[model samples]
Target: TNASPSNTQTPEHSPTTIAVVKGLAWLFGSGSKTSTAIRETRTAYDLCAKRDNEESKFIHEVCRLSPTYQTWFQIANLHVWMVRTRYRALPAPYGKAFEQEFVNHFFLDIEDRMRAALNHKAPERIVKGYLTEMRDQWMGATFSFDLGLVGSDAELSGAIWRNLFASRGLDGKGELIGKPGKIGESRAVADGKAALAELPFHLYVFSAYIRRELKRLESISDEDVMAG
Candidate 1:
């Protein structure tokens, strides 16, 4: 006897995939407060972009080269720093755990959006690997900046320059490449101090934005658990 069509079942979506989809939907939804924060952040970036300084030129170049990835990296770096600083008052272990969870969720949502935008689907293993690498990048950035904080402003500027521009040698595409032109790098280094000067204020705004989003998510999760 032939098997019935009911015997053929489609695979269910993974919890991570479902959560990412839902999270992104909520994040960009029409009435989302989170969307407001995102818009404000973009507005800040836009204002920064309008300047004709060397720092602005560097920012524009990176955005021009790899808009999506560069933009995501900048936001993620700030968010991770905010998480680390915010949780510093907690015990060491708990602080580390909270940072990891926050970073994981942030990257997951980023990956989902990236896949959607590119019209690509990666295997679970591949997705996990990407997440692992991204987490490592976050930790590396934190450690690098921590050291920079103890050193001179020049050291901090070097760290920022490396993270923002020098770290990735790739062009707009994913291919390997050399450093940016000498003139650009020279101008960037000269402008770096001024740019770094503005970061503390921006960081404060970003931290508040991130904290509000996290509390909003926690409240939703609490409501779901209670309803369940």
Candidate 2:
């Protein structure tokens, strides 16, 4: 997906830009020190706050351009997830302040748009369902964070698999298929689309959480997976 260029550019010929382009080149077909540095820096963050920013931005773009029922749900869910996990990590008053800033800048406006999309009965259930998904993602995020703090590869891998599977909405019984909705709708069913539309937000959050978790695992410095 083409990310709309930010009004703020890192400078076309500057180190960051050169590094990003070169890093993409390597990511597509090779490897390099710059790419490694980028990976390591991302690993250093608890999760990719940057990627969260991008995902939030992408959802906003979708909301603005397509504002479908599903896109509205997606945008709303992503905002809620950001508030729970990434926003929680910010320091002191700065965290709350930054979170409010994001809401004011993007999410609050999206909420209004979503409200307009809802029929006679406000889609409170849809919003609540998205919140539930956020809660689950936060739980998985915490699990991953703990794994990093403890530096346990076994725990990390196991937790990652569990998180990934659960995020997909499967259960031990194999009866629960697809992500949960606020109301009793299934993404599997046609009417479930209204319910599932915002589900991509949950998927997006989980994927970001997992990516950060894997990077944390890789940055563990001395873990030898083969030795296990």
Candidate 3:
């Protein structure tokens, strides 16, 4: 009898072939997905940036976080995290797109700010390095808050301390913890100790703000959020 078809299976796909497949898959059907993500970014940017009055009030008035690029990043990161968490309720794909746009907007805004203020006329490479460091903080906040949200009240408070307070725990007696003498760095980190004195009040208000936003977002229809 003729031997059965060769028992050997076809060779595995080559790396190049796999990459081409992925590219084609994304390209062929990604137009709407891309549009969807872009819309999310723009709408969120408008709501988050243009309507930043409340956030600014708390950060400056209640929290008293010193005005600087890092503080700005922290505030932005906090709000963005709140909104991003809400999007997790969306169907996975859509939610993923929304979350991605949320972060992309954060970085994009930072890039613009860096060019105008931080790196001011510096080479692109210098700015990129700063941005890279920021990316670590961004990712760290994402997880720290995630744990805090699910963990104990103390956990949430700890996350806020580490992030919103620049990891300055209570051990330092309201200083930079490691003897952060002076504060020429970042416009005026010297204000940090002063701000830390208000940390208790800041933590209370900020934690409340987070809880309230979570509740408000729950009531909002997915479509309404997308509309914004």
Q: Against the hidden reference, what TM-scores do the models get? A: 0.43, 0.30, 0.73
Distance (Å) between predicted and true CA of 51, model 2?
8.3
Q: Judged by TM-score, which candidate is best?
A: 3
Where is model 3 more than 4 Å wrong at Cα? 1-31, 50-57, 169-173, 176-197
How well is each residue in 112-189 modelled by candidate 3, as lDDT tens digits?
655555324565556656666666777799899999888876788788988877766455545333212111123233
* Worst window of 10 by summed lDDT in candidate 2: 1-10
Worst 10 residues of 1 by lDDT: 181-190
Q: What digit string (tens of lDDT, one per residue) describes model 1 on residues 178-212?
A: 33421112222233444445444434443344456
* Candidates' C-alpha lDDT: 0.42, 0.37, 0.61
Per-model clash counts, in order, read 0, 1, 0
**Alpha-carbon shift of residue 186 in model 3 (angstroms):** 4.7
Structure candidate 1, residue pairs in collision: none
Model 2: per-residue Cα lDDT over 31-55, one tens digit each: 2333332333223322322333456
Of 1 and 2, the candidate ahead on TM-score is 1
Q: 76, model 3: CA deviation in Å?
A: 0.6
True lDDT of residue 58, candidate 2: 51
